[model samples]
Target: MATVLGSVRAFFAQSAYSIDQENPGDVVARERLLDRAMGEARFRNSSEKLRRGRVPADGLALVARDPDGYVIGTVRLWNVEAGVDASGNAVPALLLGPLAVDPEHEGKGIGSALMRAAVTEAATRGHGAVLLVGDAPYYERFGFFADKAKHLVMPGPSERDRFLALELKQGWLGGAAGVLVPSGRRFGRAGLRKAA
Candidate 1:
């Protein structure tokens, strides 16, 4: 009986949180969590230039929820052209950013979990590469390296070293060059037009 009880406790403890697709209802909460984790500086980030007025790639936005079902983490990927290749053909890639976890939930693996989920899903969806501007030490473990993105540049000013990438398919980014541009769907202004 004690063994069975211990198993149940372990299961519950491990299940204290869950990762899932971000639903419509999670937007506000996700935004709040991002604000808390990243503060106002997140808006001025160079990556925002590519992400602004754009929607995340289909089904690439994700959220982490705590035991009480509150959103504690968020990560999203946007489609971007990794510049034209040697043959001048546009090389497509995904830009990851604003990966934020609630301040209170720091050190609980929520950010890492969200990252792994996002990258795995992007690969499963057949994306060729993933890029982001982040701390080297934290992202290096996920195969994101500066050398891979050395030839590429963000739309706005960004530290060279902070830009990193992981090619989902080997050599997917090889020969890719030029400024990254937004290739994802934009938030249509139809609603705004109607409001006007």
Candidate 2:
């Protein structure tokens, strides 16, 4: 049987597309596509503010490639301490953002494929929740909802309605109320090794 990613690609008639762990060699194309997908002003967004100068979470960055090996879509999850739990210890969560598809690839299921792969990979790696600042309508389908993040705060200004969260592990958001702070861990060029 074909994989779910393949199913999504088939749904969008994108059989030549594939999502894979990001290789450092794709950085330049990723950056160019990001610039085109999000534009230069994207730097001012709240999510960008949080990720500034920090590396994405270990093994959480992924890219969607076309048949020719070009990076056509990208989605990354960064490590963030959502807040304290009932025990007063930091609750680790993933911050998903910059989910971009190349302009030429828009209208295809590339973006959805990237989101599905990123979240699935994150959960498989033992993360409990994912948070993001984005369109409620677009992300809600992926289980992102303002209510899920009602108790948390971003590091900078953001539209209250657009900030959302999804709990891969049930109850991960309950009492997860606090500032979203970066985990401060460095991600090297090698990207973290995938979980065996």
Candidate 3:
């Protein structure tokens, strides 16, 4: 079903926009887009607990740009420990969040494009699984499901049914259980100063 929907989306997706790796120059525009799409409530999301002061996984921060070169969409993935397996070994996973597309571009498929790009990049980087707290109806089309994520938990409050996961490698999430913890590189003072 996911595959079929993916093909259908691909068939109708517009080509006027481009998906690209997020760069320093895109930071401002991306943040503005996110603010408009999610408002102040975005900062209160459960995923923000894992992402605050942490850099996204290497090469996993992405943006969708319009033909005019403006950022129209954004999505980022952060490294997280999806708890421990039954035997106690740490289970590494990527947490995807704040996927937002500009309101003007909402129906252009930019969000879906950014989603595919980020997930594809994670898979290419050999990530085991990707977790997200999002609407199941929307994200499930990308293979994210609650079944595998049932045993995993995030730091803050999140609807159990809304927490979802997609295993890039079959069985990578098998036996996984525990609270998600940030495992990505910290946003250091230097980076903070630069952003400032």
Candidate 4:
């Protein structure tokens, strides 16, 4: 199903906008797009607990630009410990969230393009899994599921059914069980250069 959707998305992507690594100048636009898509409620979501003070994972922050050189979409993935409480194993997983598209650009496939980039990049860099709090109807098409994530928990309150996980490698979340936490390296924008 995921593959089928990916192909369908690809078919529509023939004339897709350009996706690139987000730069310093892209922050404001990214923030606006996020606000428009999720409103202030986004800052209070469970995933924000992990991303609060930490920087986005290296090579995982991206923006989609329109033909006019405008940033129309944004998505970022952060680092977190998959089993911070129960096992204290320090197992790493990328947390994807705040994936937003301009209101007028919603049906253009910009959001899914960013998702594909995020998951593919994480796997290429050897990360195990990707986690997020989003609608199953939307995210499941990207291969994220609650079945594997049922064994894990989030730091703050989150709708159990909305917490989803996708293993980049086969069985990446097989033994992962515990609370997700801000387990990634400490890095703000200034410290981003230090992350691998």
lDDT of model 4 at position 11: 48
Per-prediction TM-score, please?
A: 0.89, 0.88, 0.89, 0.87
Better of 2 and 4 by TM-score: 2
Model 2 lDDT, residue 73, Cα: 93
Scored by lDDT, the top model is 3
Residue 192 of model 2 has an lDDT of: 34
The lDDT per prediction is 0.84, 0.83, 0.85, 0.80
Model 1 vs. true fold: TM: 0.89
Tens digit of lDDT per residue, candidate 4, span 70-105? 889988889888884345567788899878999989
Which order, best to worst by lDDT?
3, 1, 2, 4
TM-score of 2: 0.88
lDDT for each residue of candidate 2 in 7-26, tens digit (9 for 90 to 100): 44455455768777677688
lDDT of 1 by residue, 1-196 (tens): 1122233234436665677777777878988998888889999988999988888887688787888889888888999999989999999999998899999988987788778888888887889999999999999999999999989999999889999999999998899999999998877665223211
